[model samples]
Target: MSAKVPASPRFAYKGDRLKPLRAFCQTARLGSISRAAEALFLSQPAVTLQLQALEREFGARLLERSGRRISLTREGQELYELARPLVEGLDGLDGAFRERVRGLDAGELNVAAGSSTILYLLPKIVEAFRATHPEVRLTLHNVTGAGGLDLLRSDAVDLAVGSMLDVPADLSYEPVYRFEPMLITPRNHPLAQKAELELQDLSPYGLILPPQRLTTYRLVDLVFQQNRVPYTVALEVGGWEVIKQYVAMGLGISIVTSICLTEADRERLATRSLARYFPSRSYGVVVRKGKYLSPHARAFTELIRPALFEREDYYANGQSER
Candidate 1:
């Protein structure tokens, strides 16, 4: 006969107490007992009681009330800082658990990307992933490259995809592709007839440039700075698509990545190689250090890795072998 085994001690009550802690944190964060109550679906008195209980447990006043307003005490501020992540992590855990119960892969994969990735790459990548794992939902946060990296560090996003320039040391990156930048102008523009172009050659025309913070803008700036080329920037826009649209309208000449130009753009505009060598920008996948990746996210990464880089090399090398 098998020996009888002792059952584990009950820990459910301890875990369930997070509900009160969550309510207290929300009230502290929002600085209004009524607002916090509404947010947590509890009465004002209930939220007040929870806050009082938390303060009692810590043996200090956590909040101070003045008329209709509330503010955190010094100790409360510290506790609030600590509690915010705990609450967020618990929420993430709840989401992961629900997904698991629904016969789907658990955990969320938050992706941060720029407008270029959203417009050009993300749709195809997301579609392909969803076809195989229809139930795995992906959340995309679109921001500038710098902002994307900030989100990744803050745990707002699991991964970021874009140009790899000025990446932070705490993150890891895998190169996806290297794209050549091209100068685009209206079909009737004088430079359209040129076989090749340089920034100095295009100095006579107004240039529609991206904002200073964007990787594209930095790439263009580096080239001009290195070559000592002087030109007039007619406009500075935020996104590639917008820049292309402005260029198409004969607004001004603009430099853009070759991949950002579509067939429609080609038909409407003329593109020329820079007379001097402009450095190609490497777009890559970026993830935070030591963060957990869901199985579905890992699979998606595997799919994108080959689709973006390896297969192209295989075919190119194969043709050369022939």
Candidate 2:
């Protein structure tokens, strides 16, 4: 007789039909059998059996084992990518389907955003969302620009809000707010006295910049490169606030969004608009193409993009990809 299928407590719907796929996906995501088993509430042996069965069916090795650590092979990576959304759809069916029928009384919404956007732009809107949808759980994940896209693709976050100068083909971005880019210096600096400033004008002073991986840094690099301007980096820093703090102490000057500057900062720091030199920075909502937004998610999107969902009946019909 054939060996009996191991009992899987995590998903009980289809006997052992989906257990292998589930096991492989969890293992891929968590990067270890023990952790995947812990997450699924199953023994390590059971999870291993499920993975072995999956590998046998595919006739290809799925996981590259290294002691206790694990990684996906190329084939395994493709399969995991193909299988993840299916597994997530299965896991989130109740919430997604119930929101379809019951109309968003309770559900979870995960949003990813850059640090500054979360700190400055989202507080009031988040407050409104909390007051309006007390039953729904909303989480704001602090992710960088690239990390946000990864979260969206993995279904970890429902949507993201930030600026994007270059958007991927599989995603959509809607501009919400625009802010002028400004150059700031210590109150006593000479450039601060000028009403107009150009990229070449600030070339002399060392600039305090964010890490190169971030969009802001790239934009600055691109602009400088195009203008054939030579600038020195006084210091490398992260976050507008940190850069601002250093500039206040006369460590170096920095370019920051006008959104970051307040009247209080005006007294301590000298600011000149770089709108002529740098393009206006636009921040917005970003969502993955073709993913269905729950009613609660849609409602929050509407709060961000009032005109996009102004029809009042868009959610009544199913989501058509934007």
Give lDDT tens digits, candidate 2, residues 50-159: 88777776779989987778999999999999999999989899998877575445578899998888876777678778888888889999998678899999889989
Per-residue C-alpha lDDT of model 1 across residues 214-289, encoded as one tens digit per residue? 6667777777788788777899987778887898799998887655755466578777755345766667788898
Count steric clashes of candidate 2: 0
lDDT of 1 at 90: 88
Q: Estimate each model's TM-score.
A: 0.65, 0.64
Best by lDDT: 2
